[model samples]
Target: MAKSKRNVVTHGLSGLIGDLLVFRQRAGKTIVANRPKPSVKPPTTAMLKVRGMFRKAVIYATNIIQDLTRKAEYEKAAKNGQSAFNVAFADYLKGPEIEEDLSFANYTGQTGQKLVASIIDNFRVASVNFSIRDAGGDLIESGEAEQSEDGLDWVYTTTVDNPSFAGGVVIVKAYDQPGNETLVQVMV
Candidate 1:
């Protein structure tokens, strides 16, 4: 009776019309138009593609920094070695002047061996000490070696090896071994 002046509309038409109406309300209460809830699921294939690009960029940046740091360390060591070499060469040109003091450092070695070194002059070597222990941190073996110049190229200050633990930690003491010393180069 109240709608006699207006055309009757279907429910579907009313819904369609309601969608177009902005800020609509019913009676005294607010009429919020129904909307599709946003998905809370994981990213879709398209989203993953975008994320993967960013991820790869991050990895590349990290590796670049790591490589640069390693190069810097090598360069510093080379500079030191070169200076020492120049001084030694000048002495050699003058012909063995009173056996000047010399030192070696950054020694690294494999398992099960004692350090051995024999040189004309008294000196000390820097060493890389490896300690393999049980869960309780009890030292299984300690290994060390000495390098002449760069830490990468070295001679086993200790000459002891076993077939059982060829690659494990070994402990050795620096001693004068009157014969050939095993030469070793640390791998990158």
Candidate 2:
């Protein structure tokens, strides 16, 4: 790949020149590269699935770009040389991620005990849900968590008191703006 800087012929030029080279603009700079060749072999099942997923991401990005408010939000989050559509498409392809394991050290089967979780997403995390289950797999409590002021952590206050929470399980599900969910389970 080569960068075209102030060249008379390639300056501000984009698209394919003949069948040999492809020119494009990025971050106010012109890029020159060889034309990519099409694959001759048939796509495998996994490749087809990935293609389908990318198609869905394209559709999602198109919808986001159509909405003025949502497009502005994504545009604000976009970095240099990145467009709103690019950020939205990448966010749709990737779900929310749990930054760390759930900490139950403060949760001692007492009412009003708080459980905190750290989560992150490419765009924005919409919500976090907390669920507790006993040793027998019976649900003890479930509710939505509140986002912290700094926007990095989610806090959930326990409502019910379960003295036998030692062998229980804590489940946390984090959701991104695109409704993609990431779940994590930890033994209490």
Candidate 3:
């Protein structure tokens, strides 16, 4: 190890090291060689072309069938006096919207440092949870979050007291109380 004015340097291999060999023994002789197992080759151009043809055919047919089914359902609903907004609302009730914008302050934090997370989702978020994990995947700290008044934006501010959280992984799990959970992971 060597230390400089601003940083420390360590000299070592940067990746995994391994060794493998093949050997064969005869009646009165032995032979050895550094022979590795053969690896599988990639798909050829013809294979890809055939795969793409079948893939496109299947997807096109499935999309057309689904479109027809949805159209028929909508037509039946319209004949029953359902409004356009009702159809849209019915489609929107499938699941909670994704949280598009998730920002964090002080991603690389020290002990007792304040960490803030701001979230913006499409619908009302029921709850949010944050977790910090060490390099070995051991949880350092975790807890529920606090939401804003209107619930469109969520804010989670807490003191990072664990010293192992400075360069660990940060996990954000947000839910909309509809049994749907949105997860995002980031390296701190």
Candidate 4:
């Protein structure tokens, strides 16, 4: 058995529509073509009109869906406990919105003990101030609280040695970066 030669053959088309083919073989190269064009109907004005109608329909559908979603969100906010249900851009720009959602959780302290409070903020809390008041509404001790490790809450800790923290009230004030403050009173 003998190994055949690895011959290279070329059968490529030329011109814009690839209608012409250049052939190569043992007889050399040749170029001859009488390609017949296929019949095709050119795009008409009706086709363009249909395409424009489809585009308009798509745009109208998208806009209606967006409007419905926006209205639903606005209504939900209004129904809920949103203080400023009016979605004015100017109101949002006016300083930081006040967050009365300050809450204390898992607080473990007593009178004459190390009064430690956990304060949570709905928004960005910048500072947490705590004050121990007497029964007569007099301020006995006031100081800023410390932030926790999780960066989510503020921790207020102080010694209840002033004797005002017994039957008195614990005032926790939370301030956000937007210059909004919230005060909460907790009974000792």
Model 2, C-alpha of 182: deviation from truth (Å) = 0.5
What is the overall TM-score of model 3 with all chains considered together?
A: 0.43
After TM-score superposition, the amount by which residue 53's alpha carbon in candidate 2 deviates from its true location, in angstroms, is 1.3
lDDT tens per residue, model 4, 1-188: 33234433323323343555433234443333455566597868998887775565455434433576643543444534442223322122233322354433323344333344454433345687888777788887788877778875565666545533456777877665334566778766
Candidate 1 lDDT by residue in tens digits, 40-118? 9989999998677556545543443356663343234344445332322222222111112222232233343433333
Q: For this target, which candidate reaches the highest TM-score against the unseen true structure?
A: 2
lDDT of each: 0.35, 0.92, 0.55, 0.52
116: Cα error in model 4, Å: 4.5
- Which regions in candidate 3 have their CA more than 4 angstroms from the true location? 1-105, 108-114, 120-122
RMSD of 4: 22.6
Candidates in descending lDDT order:
2, 3, 4, 1
Give the range where candidate 4 is weakest over 10 consecutive residues by summed lDDT: 84-93
Q: What tens-digit string does per-residue lDDT give for candidate 2 at 33-108?
A: 8999999999999999999999999999999999999999999999999999999999999999996645687678
lDDT of 3 at 108: 55
Stretches of candidate 2 above 4 Å error? 1-15, 22-34
Total clashes in model 1, counting residue pairs 3 or more apart in sequence or in different chains: 14
- Highest lDDT among the candidates is held by which one? 2
